[model samples]
Target: MGEPEAARAEAALTTYEDDKLKFKVQYPSDWTTSTGETPASEEILGGGARDLFTISPPGANARDVNVTIVATPAGADFTKMGSLGDAYGFGYGLVVPLNKPRAKKGQEDRIQFAELIDSVGKGDYYKVEYKFAKPSTGINSIFFVLAGLGYDGRVSHLYTATAQYPRAEEDKWRAQVEAIIDSVVYPPTIYG
Candidate 1:
């Protein structure tokens, strides 16, 4: 990891505490926040993206838009995961230019530090979710994965969070989103 970083963000005008903060990063000021929940009908893997949730906070409708980071490993063979027999999933992705890699090996798992900056390259805010597709130990059985750029450069991770609100209510919460995501960073010590 180049720089160890963490962030606090809000999406879809909804709020949540540090219930389970796996990791955090600061985003640019332009990138918005997003939120969503896992569908009940979805299957359980390693706890990754299986749905796409979007919002403009809980009140406004422009500028600030929070996303549900629902991503899974591209290399994952759904068939390999097991029967895809009626499984539900959700996730979202943004086209971003990845910076130079600091790792000596491949760019895959080596991307220890990653985040979504602003459109103008400024530090913005973003909501992220890191789930490794496996069996969950929660009340229900869950399976999600954090696969990287498979043969194709699809989404590296699926950031799934809860923004359980409508588009028009995410006003004030929207303004603070970019700043939060922009602050995404990884601890340098951990990288070493």
Candidate 2:
């Protein structure tokens, strides 16, 4: 997506801001948000403690699609983190592996598609996507990970948006989730 696409449409959106995190994003109005804690037992990514905001559609369950935006003091070696395989290891080592095998009905999950791109604007950012199967429920799960390397004195921040839904219902949530991902904004003061 380009800068134009980065701008939010005039559709109804709910704003989430944190002066301390020095960033904000607008998600669909229908989605509900839950605040996150720092130094959590379970983390969004490795490095420093992460403050997570999980936005979910109404009536969502464990299998529903949701977006998790996080701010952490973690930093990544951008040079080593710009490929599908690299993203996989980064997630596996620092976060959750996409293809973790689950003994569900004797079926093992696998990655269906994966891509990585390094977008250089004010700084370096790696954008990644992994679509895989969830053997437990026989559904497909999609993960979009955006890592913004350090800018000036600020620590690295990551945005991870994910969806797990039946194939029949993907059309209903994909675009909405993408928009939420693109709407993320970092304060200009942090830039070099």
Candidate 3:
């Protein structure tokens, strides 16, 4: 099916798919994915949390979108997500404030996630999330991101989605990252 227009008005709902084996999600139509590099408003850090990512199309009112993969040592504890910041050097505990932020009325879970993300970014930073789900391929991952807009009205994001697979399994996550990059629909490149 064609990309379903983004819903939530300001938050358009789009269509995409994923390789459940890699636990990776793709983007809507006209979108494309790239590897080993940042996409649009996205940036891939060189140290700390290794990651791969892509961002939303540079369009009117559209926010940046990315798919990153980071890693946590096996048996790491998620309960103290806040403390894990300085503990891990990935900015988790550094960004998230000890006191949680208030979410809009009637939005507890969403608000909670938002607060967590905000804290993890450590300021001007965007997001930090976690996902230890093991995929069908048996590859585990540590995932998170930081996102917001720069003064240019363009989305800005940093994310990591690292995989814990056999060294030989590198191709799997690489393929997943490509798929997400392929899904972006950014504005046409303009070279003045």
Candidate 4:
């Protein structure tokens, strides 16, 4: 007989903690996640980053809405890393370049919105929202990246949520995605 299939993530909502990145975030149980260590030909999946986890809804493809968590190297300042404004700027600077190419033809306008939000126990995190249609498929999609520092103060974990669906269904999934972003909890940082 074949081995039993693994259980799916909870349908209601659940938390995911990355021991290596030292951060935690809540996601829908139905969404599936694949660790960065998953065997792949590329070292960095996107934005020259490492330690990533790709979260996707059932039967979704690359053009559909998905979420990715990435760990990035941090500078010496822990407080700055925790500050939402600073992190927002840092994150914006890092992602714009990577996303430029994905912008829709002629509409490659780089439009974005960002804000600072308070984390329950952690200091703060930056939330950014942006969107563009793929030039090839002409699929309009949106992405949200919640960025904050990890417990070690030496790394920043960015929770990137993305979605692409029919315009009529946007409201339903947009609210769902925002809720998931709000449920994030960062690991405790330890100073030397």
Candidate 5:
């Protein structure tokens, strides 16, 4: 038997390129794109991210359904960590503290589930799936993330792409979201 038609068919996709960062990715053709520096809230995390690229669904805000890529300098500490799991742990550690203070009233924002889905090229890249919930806001979002390490000649960097959407819409958007994350392409000359 052959692969399912749905799997074989490709969706309309548009490419987003960062000439300065030497990276590019393909997203849904109808999605909107934006670029900016890391927000101040993220600046405390190990000197902060160097750049951010966001892709949001048509007529939707990033908080609703989006894919975000954060590029940050991978210092000695990150290089020393040595594994995809460790990298993920390091990033998650930074996020938890930030979310703690934002929790509503008596409710806590927490990770309902997390899994290290896969890795490629001996830890050059990794994929993860996790569920986070803000009980007070009644929001349960599912996240699909891809993290990779690259060296941009002068410095090493970590590029993480996160795709998030409400859990209730998973059945409708999971495949497309996964496709977007999987389509990410880093500079061939920079990444090993």
Candidate 6:
């Protein structure tokens, strides 16, 4: 009665490539794409992202139903961070300052859950999942993040892909979000 499952899935996605960021990914065909310079507040490792690319579902704001990718030039400090697990810890610790100021008095934002999903390429790339609860809005957001290292001849770079959506819709969107994350092809990297 309908298209085959494989065909239907393929037809629902569109591919995006960033030459400067040197990465490729597939997002839902109905979603929109935006590119810009990443803000200092979004920097996780302190190296600061050189560029940012975001894919968002229709009618969704920047903070809702979006996947963002940032490329940061890997410095000596980043190299010394060791495994992907260690990097996640170091980066998440920085979230306090970023969140504290925006926290409301009665409804403080907090991490509901966090876990290290897996790593590939002998720790060169990793996958993690976390949930952020916003009691102010009475909504919980689930985040799926992919992190990896890439080199472009002269310098090394850290590229992170983060996908988030309302936890209430997890049953409806988790697979699609995971598909988008898994579709990423990192820039000139041995791992990914």
Relative to the true structure, how large is the alpha-carbon lDDT of every model?
0.30, 0.55, 0.33, 0.56, 0.69, 0.70
Worst 10 residues of 5 by lDDT: 111-120
Lowest summed-lDDT stretch of 10 residues in model 2?
113-122
State the lDDT of candidate 3 residue by residue for 1-192, as single tens digits: 655554433143244322211223444444444444323334464333223443333331122233533222212232222323432354454334423345566654333221232224333323444433223234233334433211111211222332122224345443433444333322211110
Relative to the true structure, candidate 6 reaches a TM of: 0.72
TM-score-sorted candidate list, best first: 6, 5, 2, 4, 3, 1
Better of 3 and 5 by lDDT: 5
lDDT of 5: 0.69
What is the C-alpha lDDT profile of model 4 across 1-192, one tens digit per residue?
Answer: 654443333346768877676667677787788876433346454344456766667765634766666665544464445444554465566455654443456665543332222222224556666554444454565556666665544554333333334334577577766677666666544441
Whole-model lDDT for model 3 versus the true structure? 0.33
Q: Write the per-residue lDDT of candidate 2 for residues 1-192, one digit (tens) a residue.
A: 544543545546888876667667778787788877667555565455567778888876634577776765434443222422444455544334333544455444342222222222223344445555555456655655555433324554444434334445667876877677677665432333
Better of 4 and 5 by lDDT: 5
List the candidate 5 regions with Cα displacement exceeding 4 Å: 1-11, 39-46, 76-123, 188-191
Per-candidate RMSD vs. true structure? 18.3, 7.0, 17.7, 8.2, 5.1, 4.8
Q: Pick the lDDT winner.
A: 6
Q: Write model 6 residue lDDT over 1-192, tens digit each, in one string.
A: 999999998998899987666788998899888899855655464545378899888876657788998888775445522543464564465333333325346545442333333333324556666666655466567787778777655566788888988988888678888889988877655332
Candidate 1, poorest ten consecutive residues by summed lDDT: 134-143
Q: What lDDT score is found at residue 34 in candidate 5? A: 88
Q: Summarize candidate 5's per-residue lDDT along 81-125 as a digit string, tens digits.
A: 244356556556534543443435554544233333333332456
For all predicted structures, in order, the TM-scores are 0.25, 0.61, 0.26, 0.61, 0.71, 0.72
lDDT of 5 at 114: 37
